[model samples]
Target: MTNHLEGVYQIHHIFSNINYRFQQLINSSSLRLKIIYCANISNEILRFNKEQIYSLSLNESFSINLIDSLFIYLESLRITSINSNELLLFISNFQSLPCLKSLTIKLLQCDINHSQIYYEIFSLKMLKYFKLSIDDYSTSLQSSSFNPNKQMSHLEYFIIDYQCFLPSITNILSYMPSIHYVSLMKLFYYRSSLETNYPSIWPNLTHLSICLTTWDTMFECFEVLISKIGSKLKFFSFKNYHRNIDYFNASRWENLILKFMPQLDKFYLKYTENVDRILRDRDNNEETNDFTRSFWIERKWILEIEINNQNILFSILPYKKQWFNEENLFKLNQLVISRININKYNYFIQDDINRVLNFTQIYHLEITNENLFIGLLLQITNCLFELRSLKIHSLLLEDDSRDLNLKEISILYSIHLTSQIKKIYLRNLTNIKQIDFLMKFSPYLSFFKIDYLHNLDIPSILRQINHTYLNSLCFYVPTAD
Candidate 1:
């Protein structure tokens, strides 16, 4: 087989384990290899052409020594899982893999000594692009200690997928003197207990993106951050889960940008809040044209607002593309579904009920109506061609005596076979008929979340759900029951 495929430059193998024949074939080939989910790979199988292979990607469990010994000349290496002890051992031997310029570790075992990890990672003098994601069990590094002489990393781009406090982020930035771009997957607020000094300004840093996790003192902490690095930032993006009314105050943002971020060429901001929390201000005749000011207009940044039954989203045009986005989240997408009604305070409106329906590229659809008829569901699925997930409050027939005609049945069957939906969330489900309809409608469904069984028993619902080949099943029950 290896003789027959002599010209092959790349190979991807997905297997439970590597055998002697596979090892012999890999040893003879000078191909860039991608081995996925091959667990407990023995060291003998990893003997390959180290000089011929410059890039390697592995998604499996194996000894750390294999990395240090086999990939000395590799320019890029990606590993899916690495524990703290293995990471520390690898750090101790960073000199072995001097050719490693781009390294990505997807999952690092949660350990408290993250400061040590950061310090060691910064010691990699030749690395340029590095991405690390730590598990949630790891706590933030309360204090960081770095030797300035040994920790100046030449890395130009960095992505950190762990949530860290403001001071912790600053501490990490202090060591990366050559970094031009940085992305913090989630930035948490600094607490009073963790005492640490913020770093000096990063003049070389040009691009920054942050997803703030805490609301308390979030703006204040960000303000302090801007005071240090704002002048040099050419691109900035911010995202948050909850809303503070001040975030929408365009004038405030304009003042900040003009005063500090003078070099800013592109800005992206997104914030969301639940409907109940912001409903009080919905009646107030507040103007929504703040974003239409000259500052934003001159920059050609247009504001887009999306309000659904659950939450309101505020974002700027040319929206930031996906960056480690959360899974199983269903939000209204304005790029796909347009022609929505503008609400009174210009925030929340009956947008989904608008008459103007067009071809929508939205991937997720959440129906919050009390009663969603079969015909309306068909219409929605027909328009949202890219829809992959559906969350409905209730599913029922418009009339009890009505039954589907030939066309309706035909449409339903088409949806069952052609629908891209892999997730179905049924909220306030009261009958088995709704479950039966949903199961048949989404034949490829992988995740089913039943928020509440209003009048149905838990055992019967579980028994019915047991029939589907689902990857996951979720149930939410209230205490009142």
Candidate 2:
């Protein structure tokens, strides 16, 4: 699925003698390392609880000859405890990494003037994605601070946070002419009286993700921010910790998105249980979960605002729709839902469900969650007439006594629509006794992979089933930690 990855090699600093061995092996390969992280490579005092830095000695005048050795072919690199006293010396070797596109830098402590630091960062022409976790909010970057000679035209994504709020951030962004994606970790840290008249600053920005401190401050620069950057944006996502649903003006927000972002997508809106009042009816406890949608769908393409406590990604797949035909809609074959958030009986509207139900070409389906399979699983099994490979992920059960839900057990009987089902992967699933219930759906099912097999009676259950059709059966017991 990914063409960018060629090979991955990681050297963890787990032992005393691994460092010398790592250097010896690194020189053996001529191929460039796309990603490299020498975890805890520094011998400095671990004052902060950040990821341990693994490099050379903590002496004041240490040789960075080792960094030059491995960094010659690195595309992505991470370094820790870079000398705060002599910051420029630490980054002098950065020019050697001509192919370096991504860098994550964390410093122990320092108060280097923001001008020099900002200049150094902008000078990296090839660097695209940079995470400035330096925790220094002070900035001397203004409208004129950017050097015309030092232009980062290739930079696309940046992760930067400043406590002074949007004014400071806006000052920095005014210089970056080609960045398409930016993660403003703190968009509203404090109120700013500074006004931004520059609209061209965010002209090329297509993907914008902001972590708002509160919705109260969201409306402060709401109109200005959206009016400037929203029109060209393809993807927009914002998440805050507050529990207020009133802050999100759905109609106004919809209009803004409609007017600004025309190239939207069909991604699901995933939210956690904390804001249940807005999406789920708390009072209504019926057989079906009363789920409300915050997204929109029209002509098979969807524009959505997703919220999740788990992992959230802000990405947009660009396609020319004018040259595309209607037949491309049915080309989907793989459907995967990681972190199953939907509970039983949770369903969408008739039209909404049709979008998913009509994906008849889907064969590889996957679902993973800590507990309770989504209600859509039943709908999928009942509707997907051609499902072949089914995979389910669940947490390890507390004890072997607990049994799978009755609704879960009944899926074997409802999988008649998927007559071509050949393989099944139940990964990290608890209660192996449930394997006995598969006698009904075992006729055409040949390959079975079951992980974390806690119960001892799984062998006896498989023996009961006639192995004439079952070609592969793998039962793995998890090694004790």
Candidate 3:
């Protein structure tokens, strides 16, 4: 059993007695184990000294004392099953990690005290990513005004998983001027909480997704919210559950998009069975609804709309070309062309890579399968020397044809010999044996969209990595019907 555990990376399902033998086992395993998915644990765990751990999804048993010892340099942390007060205390007390960037807190409850909760979040100056999820038993109304003026410069993406009233959402947005994406799992409002006089705005917000569960009219609520969104807004999504309003006028949405969101590219609308009719009618009127059919035809101004069953999507063609000029090109740090349409070849992206080769400062690059991305990588290696984030879709190690092999994988690694990519996203790679091969690069990757991970794979992948301060890990296994 000991020999079999030699290169293991995870110490999971562990509930044990702490003896000298356990101490030896821990010391032997400490060098490789970089992650802990702990269960019932005790203070004795402090004796293990799993030094390389950079990410922890800890339980309540790993209380404040254990936390103080373990949280020193962790880049990502998810505290499972804790109450709001405990979360606030932990965050407030956490005064010194200069590198902690991504944080996920799963609270068993919440408080309406917005200032206290938010102050701790904004206080983490280097934190760019944040996710807060509340348990089902949570009862906070979140009605109080969060009069916020402080600017959180590093805050970029914020996701709050609670049924919150709009004032809290709007107020929170007002404080996070640098935020790009805002996702609210659910939305609720009391009649009194809707203050007509309060003026708030998220100046840099680009994407917004919200869930609505109410029978009351949302038009007035939407109008107030939309008025605050100045032109940088691009995507807006509404997911209606438990209730459906009289069908929203298509013209109303279009007019709102035209007037308030000049740069809007896409929007989503979803609801229940009144949703049933919307789906069918949307399909029948697909072409007319599409914001535009061709970029050249409507290059000046016009949006394309399409329906994917229940989803009504609007596409804005050439909306990004205005950035092809010298001034805006400097601002193009993130480029995402990772979506692979099964039906068509991604030749357009190949052209884009060549066209943007003159651009020398892009920090993030997202590419799809090699049929669209292989050559682009070679071109990018020459131009973008400061690349920090690389997201690739459908990264398969094996294909029927003989274009790539282990040697090719090494060549791909050579391309990044000069760049330090901090975040990586890859999906749909079915070759199981290559997981170990990929593990060799785990030390270099701060974030991974490992959608095909299995339980047995964690130990080995984590074993060799002395995780960096920028580390974050995400696992996804596609659900079976």
Question: Highest lDDT among the candidates is held by which one?
Answer: 1
- Per-residue CA lDDT of model 1 for 1-481, tens digit only, reads 8865753423323332356567667776555554432555533345645644577776766666666645656788777777776777766766677788988876555564666666677777678999888775345434554455644778899898877666666666777778889998777766551444545546788999988776765455566667667888999998875576566556667878898899998899886755455644332334432565567767756564555435666676542433212242223343322223334432223334221122113566666666766755665676566677776777776545455556557878787657887877777787877777777788887888888777788788766664455787788877874
Candidate 2 backbone collisions, by pair: 40-52, 40-53, 40-54, 41-53, 41-54, 41-55, 42-53, 42-54, 42-55
Alpha carbon deviation, residue 403, candidate 2 (Å): 12
Task: Give stretches of model 3 more than 4 Å off.
Answer: 1-34, 40-51, 69-72, 111-114, 147-153, 189-201, 245-248, 274-481
- Model 2: number of backbone collisions: 9
In model 1, state the lDDT of residue 423. 79
Per-residue lDDT tens digits of candidate 2, residues 1-481?
A: 2432322222233443587776555534442322232336432222221122222223233455444533444566665556454566666667766666877666554466445666777777788887665544333112233343635446688776533256556666777888788887666633342265554766788777776654465444565576766667766666554443333444444565667566644212222224224334222232122112223323233221222333222111222242112133333234455433443434312232233332124545565545433334554554556666666775333324344456545665655544666677777545543454443554577777877655656656566557557777777866669
Once superposed on the true structure, which residue ranges of model 2 sit more than 4 Å away at CA? 1-76, 83-85, 92-100, 135-154, 161-164, 189-194, 246-252, 266-295, 299-481
Q: In lDDT terms, how accurate is model 3?
A: 0.55
lDDT of each: 0.65, 0.50, 0.55
Structure candidate 3, residue pairs in collision: 9-459, 10-459, 290-304, 290-305, 291-303, 291-304, 291-305, 292-303, 292-304
Deviation in Å, model 3, residue 208 alpha carbon = 1.1
Q: Which candidate has the highest TM-score of all?
A: 1
